[model samples]
Target: MHGPSPRRPPMRAGSLRDGMTSRRDRMNHVVLTGDRPTGPLHLGHYFGSLANRVRLQDTYEMYVLIADYQVITDRDLPGSIQRNITELLLDYLAVGIDPAKVIVFQHSAIPELNQLLLPFLSLVSVAELSRNPTVKDEIAHSSQQAVSGLMYTYPVHQAADILFCKGTLVPVGRDQLPHVEVTRLVARRFNERYGEVFPLPEAMMGEQPLLKGLDGGKMSKSRGNAIALSATEDETAALIRKARTDSERLITFDETNRPEVANLLTLAGLCLGRAPRDIADEIGYGGAAALKRLVTEAVNEFLRPIRKRRAEHTEGDVRRILAEGNERARERAVITLGEVRDAMGF
Candidate 1:
């Protein structure tokens, strides 16, 4: 017989500060993650980092940054960036990230973070910056004929974002590993030169499944193939209906032979919390048309509540939330920057 139902762990009685020597001495790790406010977040972003952020918020001292400054590396439209920043804030709240638990702020609002970037630039060489594969890949895809200095040095700015908060953990995909590496390198170099001021941040790599666009390419707003989180239920249905699928009579999980059908199945599996093969097996006899219909319905159902919640918030509400978060973030950044300045004799 099964052993008596497993008992839950007993709760500790004393205050955390009483048990610990200092509030800072308590060893909870800080996590830093973010998105550039270039456009509205979508399902691709949700699976990539948003869902993971929700899971990790309670366990870690979470800092969610909206990289408004980083958005200018390619875009010059201030109005568009401003609009997207508000949208990103609403999206974060709609996805269940409690403001009380998570520190969400605009990247540009933290002036100290930008101040920390100055010294970090000197610690890293131009050659090393040029060697970052993520930067190189981005340059190749970017429409700009020549890369800007800001684009080349943005990784160092990212290092400041991590070190400014003494972040120990960063959640990122494989493609973003290079940026995190730069942050680690900058941290080590600064510590060696001055003193041990910043924690060496490590990558918390997750199984970030990249979702494809309806056109079977990478999901992107610029490409006009993405199904945005802000999309209405009818809009989501129409987008999925037009998604590319092969002429296969039976559903199968053959990425090589049936990528389009496989993509649809992957989407359904992610939304429904089942394996792609399991989804394929269930829909095996239904054919491609039936499979598409199933995916469309599932996606709409999943987004219904999220869309409704997003609609409830106004622009003014987002601004108020952001103003409060910026004040809180500045206080934390000030403490870290003070430590860094003292270490460097600034």
Candidate 2:
């Protein structure tokens, strides 16, 4: 029903290669990062990526995408997606991700960006897609008995998310490295088959890439082990109270044997900006209760300003930010799509 829109005359071969090189050089500083709007972000998100995003915005040209379409990749569409998007924006703002400095946009709003998936999907084989470890893990853990086609080619869709923005720096945890590798492969293959119309994005890992859940498993909103960024002080305390800590009275940061205890220390240390072992030493004979009390206090204190900022925002403010960001993202997507179309001689 739709076709490649009219674009400028294709660049000459030599000039096109030169243009690609120039664009790649400029794109080296562009950082693409985002989260799925399935639920409110939690402490794991804070230490894992949100904190790093706040720090990176000042140094790089950052684009924070709300991956709305990815919500249904492993499950049915959630009715809370609309509210979740607003909450995600609030979380981003509360954590000092200045919308003025960062382009925060929703995925479903940009048709041109999704349009990239068709071309990108063709560059990779089904076998290769099946071989992606992340995809395999997701499928293994998924509730659905049968995986959707969208879930299968998720890596390629991610490639579109990265390449559509000419994003060369992608912030991801170690587990997510494979998805970024797929993006790089698509970029390399596309360039080899057509022309260099994309920049191979590099994955940027944060200092603390993974944070454990309260239950000593992966901290996830769906798993009910994470404390949301918007959680009240009382709510945070209640959650931490239930956090799985061992019966060993003496507090020590031994991650191997005493992982649960170490996790509590890690959470407190992250909030206090100190070493977990130091925090453990400070709570020497006090044990889990004392450690829990300290973590609750430290976490609540650290989140006070962020909660205040979150409370200050209204739904109207969120809509305005999304509008401005969507406009900017669409502008970039249009230009990138046109270049891709021209390069493919469409």
In candidate 2, the residue pairs with backbone N, CA or C atoms under 3 Å apart (3 or more residues apart, or in different chains) clash, namely none
Off by over 4 Å in 2: 1-28
Q: How many residue pairs clash in each candidate?
A: 0, 0
Give lDDT for model 2: 0.82
Query: lDDT scores for all predictions?
Result: 0.78, 0.82
Candidate 2, residue 133: the lDDT equals: 96
C-alpha lDDT of residue 89 in model 2: 91
How would you encode candidate 1's per-residue C-alpha lDDT over 210-292 as one tens digit per residue?
67888998777667788888898788888888899877688899888888888888888777767889989988878878898
Give the residue spans of candidate 1 off by over 4 A: 1-27
